[model samples]
Target: MELVPFKDTGKAPAQNFTGDVYVTSIKTPTEPSRLTAALVRFTPGARTNWHSHALGQTLHVTEGVGYVGTRDGKVIRMRAGDTVWTPPGEEHWHGGTATTFMCHIAMLEASAEGDPTTWLEPVTDETYQSAGN
Candidate 1:
């Protein structure tokens, strides 16, 4: 057994996200564990760029309100204690609501080559604000 000390990774790059975002690596893949987990926090209106996981991803909301936007014009609102699952290879983005800060524990499995995610273009206002914007 071992303890993983807390570390602040700082603001997420604007190229990959919008607004203020921070992440704390929780657990990374190892020889015996392929699970990758992180604590992701977002300030009001902050969000991730479109991305997908090789083995899908699970998000367990821990604070505030947010929205999970999918490529098919779906924007699902989320709140603390709520959980959502994104299927493998499905393009999507998650973020805090316009008026609230939000945080979630994101979990996914590393791929065979240890690459777990593929990030794509940023979600545009036409697709992120709402189903049809």
Candidate 2:
């Protein structure tokens, strides 16, 4: 195995997130593989739009408080050591709390057709308001 160089991809665009968000690539599909991973950092109140991974996705929280929610309105409160797994094609969104910056290691595998994630509409204010810190 070789060391994969880390790349700072910079802040996620507002179109894909509600507030300031950043990502650092830890690993990418090297070839003949679909595995990819990144360290994602979210500013307070920042969050991803509704999305899902093709194979599944694993999130390991690295710092501060974060929130992950599903369509059915089940919001999971996560801390620095928390780990969460979202099954394949299960639409969801995650982000930092209103008052805290958060960071997590996001790991997922792309499908054979080179599809890794499917992005849906942004989480509405009505939906996000229902979440708990």
Candidate 3:
């Protein structure tokens, strides 16, 4: 029964993303828990680099349109209230579309020992355009 101190929204690190982005961490469970949550916002045409969670990740869209793409060439267009899940080790990237700001609550679980998130190369114009965005 303790309160977690809220922190100010911060700019997302370029090391983990491709363009301008920001995030505000909402919750990170203590030692006994393994969950982490954040409110992530992507500027128009901004997105994350291809990466995957060790356990998995879930995103609940809160506003604007979102574009999610996988290596399989599928791009999912999601809107407010839409939920998207990426299974463990699935390579994918997500962000705001060409003309809108997007926000989502992202949830992730800590991975077991010896298994961590794997980040891949940046998404290229070829791949991004392939998404039809």
Candidate 4:
């Protein structure tokens, strides 16, 4: 096994995220590997847009508090050591709560065709505010 070098953290794109968020690459698919992972951090009130994965996704909370939500209005409060999984093709969003900064390790596998995620519209302020309700 080879050790991977650390990479710099970067801000999450405004096009796909609301408020302040950062991401640092952990691993990316290479050759026979189809897995991808990253360390994602979010400031209070920051969140991802509605999105789905071709092969599903998993997130493990590492610090602070956050919420994971779905189109069906299901919201899960996640704290450090908590993990959540979203099945393939299910639209969802995740991020920090209004009063807490959050950090999680995001993991997923690319589809056979190499596609992993499809991002959709941003989660509305009303929707974000209603998380966990």
Candidate 5:
């Protein structure tokens, strides 16, 4: 048993997100592991750019309402305690609702080798609005 050091809550880079967002590292496997966890917070109307992990990702909502959208224009509305999963290489984005702040614990599987996360273009406003907020 050990206590890992806490990381600073810094703004999420625009390179991977749209609008203002922040993330704090909760756990990062040092060796013989490929799992990572983060506590991500999104401001109202903020969200991630379309992206996917090589192995997949899971999100567990902890507060407020969250929006999850897929490449096919399907948006899932999630509330506190809700859990969502994105299969390997599936394009999607997740974030806060238009009028609420949102936070979730993101679990990502690190690629073994040669495979990496594929990031796609940003989600357009037209598609965002279609999610019905």
Candidate 6:
């Protein structure tokens, strides 16, 4: 087995994120490997846009508190050591709570086209506020 080199941390694009978020690539698809993984950090009030994966996604929280929410209004409060899964094609968003920072390892499989995620519109302030503290 070969050790993977560390990748530089990068800001999650504003086009797909709200507030401040950082991502460090942990694993990227190589020949015969469709898996992709990253360590994502979110500042207070930071969050992802509504998006979905072709093969579902899993997140394991490493620090602080956060919320994982879906189109059906289901929301899960996640804390350190918590893990959550979103099934394929289910629109969802996740991020730090308003007063806490959150970090999680996100894992998913890439689609045949090499893109795993389809990002939709930004979650509005109203929608975010509704998520509660």
For every candidate structure, what is the RMSD over all alpha carbons to the true structure, in angstroms? 1.6, 1.3, 1.6, 0.8, 1.4, 0.9
Candidate 1, residue 11: the lDDT equals 73
Query: Which 10 residues in a row give candidate 6 its minimum summed lDDT?
Result: 124-133
Candidate number with greatest lDDT = 4
- The deviation in Å at residue 60 for candidate 6 is 0.4
lDDT (CA) for every model shown?
0.88, 0.90, 0.86, 0.96, 0.87, 0.95
What tens-digit string does per-residue lDDT give for candidate 2 at 4-27?
665767888787788899998887
Instruction: State the local distance difference test value for candidate 5.
Output: 0.87
Of 5 and 6, the candidate ahead on lDDT is 6
Q: Residue by residue across 11-102, what tens digits does model 6's lDDT show?
A: 99999999999999999999798999999999999999999999999999999999999999888999999999999999999999999999
Per-residue error for 110 in candidate 4, Å, reads 0.9
How do the residues 51-118 of candidate 5 rate in per-residue lDDT, one tens digit apiece?
A: 88888899999999989999888889999999999998889999998889999999986787743467
Q: Order the candidates by TM-score, highest first — what do you get?
A: 4, 6, 5, 2, 1, 3
Global CA lDDT of candidate 4, please?
0.96
Residue 111 of model 4, lDDT score: 90
For model 1 the TM-score comes to 0.92
Which is better, 1 or 2, measured by lDDT? 2
Q: What TM-score against the true fold does each predicted structure earn?
A: 0.92, 0.94, 0.92, 0.97, 0.94, 0.97
Off by over 4 Å in 4: none
What is the lDDT for 81 in model 1?
Answer: 99
Residue 53 deviation, candidate 6, in Å? 0.3
